[model samples]
Structure formats: structure tokens, C-alpha cells
Target: MKTIAINGSPRKGWNTHILVEEALKGAASKGSDTELVNLYDLNFKGCISCFECKRRGGKSFGRCAAGDDLKPVLDRIHTCDALIIGSPIYISEVTAAVRALFERLTFQYITYSKDRKTFFTRRVPTALIYTMNISEPAIESMGYAEKFKFYEDRFNQIIGPAKTLVSTETWQTTDYSKYEMTMFDGEARKKRREEIFPQDKRKAFELGAGLV
Candidate 1:
């Protein structure tokens, strides 16, 4: 099996990278070939909404018309067995770079009939990983949960439902002394770090390994 993991985080070796790396490691251990693509390192433009793809009909038909870095990535995605996308939430939404990548990737697959309804019947299996500073409950309370659902529905429309994994408030500690007493409870934070994050990371890894 071959799996492709897309890291949408701007930082190269940070939280998103670590999660994707762990997932890829899991896939590799299972004898699956895996590739990781960092969007920040690529040169890609957002979709132009030119509707040229729908007009054409071939392997290139479903590809973005814009000549940018996303074209090759799109081609790779078409051939991969399983896809994992990881992004950091910013301002209650996906980062601009990641959002643009999604736009370019998904917009070309849409087809509309006389009824003016868009449909994407050709689909693939995909997984979504979102890392944010806010806790899951707080994110939900702030209406950020819908952002994931929106992406889920969009991906489902083109590629089936994605199994989403979320990592909340993952930040490295620089100075422990500066934090408040309640916040600086080292034991509690350590427990969460060593226990919870590893479990989540392992889950992501297993998901990659199980890809068909």
C-alpha cells in the first residue's frame, strides 16, 4: 500500500510535522510506502475559478488549470492509496495556505448539470489532522467545530468522509518560571504530554498503517 501525507503547517519541524512523521512511521512499519508533502515548501496558487477543468475531459480534466506548485501534488494525490492532511487552525479556520491548497484541489473536481447543483462522484479515502492551541471543547464552543465539518463534507462530496484527528493546545514550553502556579503544575502537564499526546500520535500512525 502507498500513503501520502500532506503537512499543511507552515512550520517545518513543529507539531504538525511531528504528527505526520509519526503517522508515516506507522505506515512504514506496516510495510507501506509513504510520502510526505510540506505545503510551505511548495509554490502553489489558489484556484482561479476559471471552470476550465469541467470543460475538458481526460486525466488532466480534473486538474487545476492554474500552472502552479499544486499541479504536481494534485497528480500525486490522484494516484495515492490513502491521503492524510494535517493543518493548524488559525483564527477559527484553516491556515490560508492550506485553504488555498484545498480550493485548488477540490474545485476542479466539481461538475454541475442544468439544475446548477455540483456533484463529485469520483472519490478517494482521506484522513484529516487538525492541530490547534485551543482545547477541543473550547473550539467547539467557539464555533470552530463547524470548520472541520465543512471540510469533512467537502471532502466527502469528492472523496468520501475523512477520519479526523485533532490535537489541541500543543505548544513547547520555553520558560516554566513565567507561568502562573496553576498553569505551571509540571506533573499534570507532563502526564498529558507523555500520555495523551503519544496516544493520539499513535492513533494517527495506526490510521496510516491501516490504509487500503
Candidate 2:
């Protein structure tokens, strides 16, 4: 089996990347060859409303016609057994790169007919991971949980059975004093990173293995 993990965060060694890597490791341990993709490394845009994928009898029907770096990634996902996507919360939403990938990946398979919902041939297990500076208790109050549910519901309907893993109060920087972010205590963040992040990683690993 092949499982593909996509990292939506720009920072390679940060929380989102680390968790995605851990998930891949878990899939690897299950004897599934896995790949990790960094969305920032590619140059692409969100769906341009070309509607070529929806065209009947068209050569590019049921596929994204946009030619760019994201094309190959979408091609790989079409054949993968499982998928894992991780991103850091930016402005209370996923990063722009992740959003672009999401649109291109999901919109292609979507159909307008009432007879069929998607053109995808098979169901692929999926996971969504999110890391944020806010505490766990704040997720609902901040409407993040509602947003996450919306994404998960879409993935479930269009892709496959989906689950989510969240890491809260993420450590943003080694030296927070360098930035003007005075709202957070750097030491407390460091303590939580040391104490809680490992547990998060373990959960990510299990989540991946379960996908297999």
C-alpha cells in the first residue's frame, strides 16, 4: 500500500512537518511505502473555475487541467491508498498553499450531477492534522472546531473515512524574544512543547498506522 503525507506548513522542522513525518513513519512501520509532500515547494493556484473537469466527453474530464507543480502530486494522490495532510493554523485557517492544494485535489473529482457525487473510483483513508498556538480549550470557542468539522465532512463525503489530530499551544520559535509577540510566554510554550508534543507525535503515529 502507498500512503502520501502532505505538509502544508512552510517550516520544514516545525510542528506540522514533524507530525506529518511521524505519521509517515507510522505508515512505513505498517509496511506501506510512504511519501511526504511539502506544498510550499510547489508553485500552484487554487481552482480557476475552468470547469474542464466537469465537461462531458472532454479529454480532461474528471481531472484538473491546470498544468503546474501540483499536477504530479494530484496524480500520485489519485493512486495512493491513504492520505495525510498537516498544516499550522494561519489566521484561523489553513495556509494559502494548503487551501490551493485542497481545491485542486478535491474539486477535480467532484461532479455536478445528482446521480453521482464524485468521480473517484475508490475510497482512500484520510487524516487531517492541525497545529496552533492556541490552547486546546480555545478550539471550540474560537470556531476552529466548527471549521475543522466542515473540512472533515467534505473529505469524508468526497474522499473517504477521515480523522483529525490536533496539536495546541505549539512552540513557534526557539527564541520568541526576537519577535514582537508579547502575548505568549516563551518559557511556558517551551515547557508544553517538551511535555506535550511528544504525546501528540505518538497520536500522529497511531493515526497513520490506523490508516493502513
Q: What does candidate 1's lDDT look like per residue over 81-165, in tens digits? A: 7788889888778888889988887887677767644434545678888888676689778887787888988887776657788
- Spell out the clash pairs found in candidate 1: none
Error of 2 at 55 (Å): 0.9
Clashing pairs in 2: none
| Sliding window of 10 residues with minimal summed lDDT for model 2 | 112-121
Provide the clashing-pair count of each candidate structure: 0, 0
Q: How close is every model to the real structure, measured as TM-score?
A: 0.84, 0.98
Residue 7 local lDDT, model 2: 99
Error of 2 at 103 (Å): 0.5
| Model 1: CA > 4 A from native | 56-60, 114-122, 172-191
Q: Which stretches of candidate 2 lie over 4 Å from their true place?
A: none
| lDDT score, candidate 1 | 0.77
Per-residue accuracy of model 2 over 84-188 as CA lDDT, tens digit each: 999999998999999998899999999989886798979999999999989899999989999999999989988999999999999999999999999999999
Error of 2 at 188 (Å): 0.6
